[model samples]
Target chain A: MDMLEQYLPFFTKLTPQQQAVLSQNTTRHTAKKGEIVHNGSLDCIGILILVRGQFRVFTLSEEGREITLYRLWERDICLLSASCMLNSIQFDVSVEAKKETEYWKIPASVYRKVMQQAAPMANYTGELLAARFSDVMWLMDQILYKRMDSRLAAFLLEESQLEGGRELKMTHEAIARHLGSAREVVTRMLKYFQSEGLVALSRGSVTISDETGLRKLAEESLR
Target chain B: MDMLEQYLPFFTKLTPQQQAVLSQNTTRHTAKKGEIVHNGSLDCIGILILVRGQFRVFTLSEEGREITLYRLWERDICLLSASCMLNSIQFDVSVEAKKETEYWKIPASVYRKVMQQAAPMANYTGELLAARFSDVMWLMDQILYKRMDSRLAAFLLEESQLEGGRELKMTHEAIARHLGSAREVVTRMLKYFQSEGLVALSRGSVTISDETGLRKLAEESLR
Candidate 1:
């Protein structure tokens, strides 16, 4: 199966006739690092499904701070922006390629038409949206109750699990911005981790040396 | 025009035709103050639409602290228990009537059938859920950076506006729980507000004397 076929849900469940219609409507694109797939002011387009690499979904505060709301990877669909197509509302969050990424952008009009004709597709979309709602609620809980250090640790653990690697290609500034904290604070924390032999940091990169120690720190700081 | 009309988005957009179907299927109930509409373990059989009075949606943390997630008034459809309906997942939050309330409960199966048959109703429900997603994101932002005092002030402003009155039916303990702060802290802040001639407080109630002043306090504390 191709990238789009592998990533899009309900494709297999669709009748061959239905799949042919969708294949004709969907377009694939490659985004370079730092390229924005969608901006807050953009007109509502179709949902984008990440096929390869990573993207960050974020919004700017009134005070000009960038708050990271979600990290999207392979097989994840961006439904937050999907509402815009139905209501004519501009996208509220921007999607940027964190690395060289491939995604299938399906037009909302075609998707709607297909959904109208295919009950399974409509149900799948609804289920996908409901899952996103649950994930947003979970993120809200973390923001309300989890400390910054613990949140940062959780972020690292999540990324590690996603990429299946200890080495992280992220700068302290990037991590700090994602955590909604100051770069200096993240730098100091990284130094502390290094002294404690929990992590090794080099220029613009970090490798976890002790996952168990990091988990302990996360639990301790969460309390 | 009835309570069913107000909650048309929850099931299907009620045409004069479909509206009649809903009126026949739904049952209305009066929830007394402090009544639990749905607990954490209850099977979610239907969607609940508040027709009158108020309700609070909260979840208890592992440490046994109540975290206020949402407040619902007339015409608001509750979706926190949606996961229970979709996946049979246990509800993590509890819905309780904050005051004597009237609501209509429609079975989940019936609601799904309506959406499948009615395009307008599907679109309306989609829009409502999208707005809810936006609200959740805003609340996450508040939780991340806004101090407890600012959150409390914002909550007061929101609730007061909803009531369309200066007098709010809430106690300091209630406000503290909503703001995720200690009761003593809320009491101290109310005293500060009273000293500044911004509000007057009594048991179970507070009256805003200076709306502009409170708005300013909320904005400043948010910074």
Candidate 2:
């Protein structure tokens, strides 16, 4: 399938000429599960418009601890990868494929040219940038104000919605990385949740049994 | 001075007609020390270009804890205040005057129109948005990976840089709010710093006696 054809719905406001320039210059790339796609590169920067699979946009500490800034799903657009567009951007975020993923990569120069000529595209880019800022702020708030149990509960709730069911099929290690926590901490919290009868743990998955209890615990910090 | 006349250097990219519209519509506002200037207003959103004094951009929790996201000094441009320009921005940040401040208030509608008409202005806005993202991400990284002592040390170092002195005049309570910590915790850390001869504590002030030691302590977590 043509890359532009797949993302035409996303770029609905683009003129035909602008779309042609982007479609011709935007390249498609694929990554296997657990592959690091973009690192701290100075020259190679552009917008990543996800067409399929998932991405973990995260930061890795010098000590090697991982904390996910956020995740990107189908149709989500990322701008941190295009940090070179702004010399003032000192963000050091990495994008990793959580699973087999494919996306269109629009080079920064091409996007810049198109954006200069297209008001809709520029506005859309601005809005995307704004949304990402909101997501980062929300994450910071949760980490600062919310307790570990509250954060874990909220993450589980978010995962349940994404998975479309009660059971979450992820390891404690993966969950720890997502929450910027230790695996032992996550396991201990899971045990506490089980004791409270909020969730039931299986070999690799945890099922929510008392969602109301979990919800309250998740929002306990706010109150 | 006219608001536009004062900020003309910042908006050098604007066309003369665009300048006329923004200059005519932009208003100047004043805030006393410790006054709330912008709350959660959706309608009154716009760019805040500080001409003098300081602004603390931060978030407040229901429990009344305050954690500063960043600060705006003389000549700094803030886009989060103009968040209404992008409907996707869900950042709920408030601005407070750290000191008597005078700034230009470019309303969202006027700023949006000017941005759409001027490519340079649009690009500059994008870069500012990107820089803010970097600031937020850096704060999150510190909170997640760095220990309380390291974070406190780093905060003091930053304050020193901002104040251009080894002695800081901030109270422990004010310092705690900035670091998202408790006043008791900040006091305890100060005592430790004093005991180690790294700093000298007097009534309502902490003076750094050993800058190298403090710098090392500030960066200990990253190493």
lDDT of 2 at A134: 81
Query: Lowest summed lDDT over 10 consecutive residues: which window, candidate 2 chain A?
Result: A1-10
lDDT of 1 by residue, A1-223 (tens): 2444676656787778778877887888899999987877565667888889898888765556676777888888886655555552323777789899998888877777776656556655666666666666666666555666677777777778877899998998888777777788789888888898888999989898989988986786446
Error of model 2, residue A74, in angstroms? 1.5
Candidate 1 lDDT over B5-67, as tens digits, reads: 546643343466667766777888899998888776555647788889987877765566565
Which is the leading candidate under lDDT?
2
How is the predicted docking of candidate 2 categorized under the CAPRI scheme? medium
Candidate 1's displacement at residue A85, Å, is 2.0
TM-score of chain B of each: 0.59, 0.87
> What residue pairs clash in candidate 2, if any at all?
none
- The parts of candidate 2 lying over 4 Å away from their true place are A1-16, A42-45, A148-223, B1-12, B41-45, B164-166
Q: Which pairs clash in the backbone of model 1?
A: B13-B121
What lDDT does the true structure give each of the candidates? 0.71, 0.80
